[model samples]
Target: MQDKPENLSREYILPDGRSVTVGDQLFRAPEALFAPREVEAQGPGVVGMVLRSLARCSSRIQLDILRNVVLSGGSTLFQGFKERLLKDLQAAIPSIAPVKIFSPENRILTAFRNMWITREDYYEVGEHKVKDI
Candidate 1:
């Protein structure tokens, strides 16, 4: 018989046969919006929208660990992005600590950055407080 192809959908049936979905996850990152500037223009007010969506997400997620949300990738390159995103998420969801957006000065070497993080211990320690974290 030919090899069967696995379904690529986000939804799936678990061992007990109940269907599970990753659920309606909403990203507060401006990049997720087509016209991100619109939200940015309004500033922290948009966090209300994002928080409402997140609250409705399926409870299957372990929220304790979920509080520390990280945003990587090219699209998060807006100026003052991390500060803005955190302010909004915090205002709307008081329980959610903050949103951390990682931005490298040189966007071209994201892959290299990932490799560097993996081998971070091999590199010499620096006085940078962020690096200490």
Candidate 2:
């Protein structure tokens, strides 16, 4: 017999022999994050939040912010999250020259990566202050 093909679908039968399928489960939670239509969960979605943030910033740096967008965090690891966000953002701000989104492979360390100072950078650490040497 030929080798068995791998089960590629997100659904499967339970050990009890009941058919357990993904159905709408895959998109349910994430859909709420992008388009929260339920009145009980009324709040801004991810795209809405990002747009709001950009709106608060001065117009001068908006393009820069949009062009160099970096998305870190566990939620961003979800499939197609970045692509969806990019599409939404591009639609929302068509005037921006370009919208770039970066999601690092090691998302858990993304936040900490920028918190350290490299030895190559000159720095004088004084009491209650830090200054470049």
Candidate 3:
């Protein structure tokens, strides 16, 4: 996060010809994912969410899921977000399973396509096809 370029700053101008320089604003939103307490709000952070999800899955698949974690959404694009998430998850998850986090080249598009899959892309059930559902 500290490696951000110097010129990467957000600025606001006041009515009296004064300017307000905003630094690190880009890093703030994603910070909530890791340190929700610092942001001061309800609910668990991203690591907590992942742990909760892992807890619900079968023990056999838990390690596999951790090893192949895929993060979706625009917030995942933040610098070092994936690495930080992996580090936190690794520390929190029990066992010595390796943790890997992957963000798709275009996560939003991938999510949209997954939600809107074509009929031919899905398998058929006992008496009905995917399109029938």
Best by lDDT: 3
Which parts of model 2 are misplaced by more than 4 Å?
A: 1-21, 38-40, 109-133
Off by over 4 Å in 3: 1-21, 115-133
Q: Poorest 10 consecutive residues of model 3 by lDDT?
A: 123-132
User: Residue-wise lDDT of candidate 3 within 1-133, one digit each (tens)?
Assistant: 4556445787899999999987777677778888888789777899999999999999999888988999888778888988899888878866578888888888756556645545465543433443454
Candidate 2: tens digits of C-alpha lDDT, residues 23-127: 555666677789887524878899999989999999999889998899888778777899999988889887546999988789867776656555544245442
TM-scores, all models, native as reference: 0.34, 0.65, 0.69
The whole-model lDDT of each prediction reads 0.52, 0.76, 0.79
10, model 3: CA deviation in Å?
A: 5.8
lDDT winner between candidates 1 and 2: 2
Clashing pairs in 3: none
lDDT of 1 by residue, 1-133 (tens): 6432232225778999999764323233444443346555543234555556567777665364246555555555554556777766655554544444445566645545644543365344543533654
Any idea how many clashes model 3 has?
0
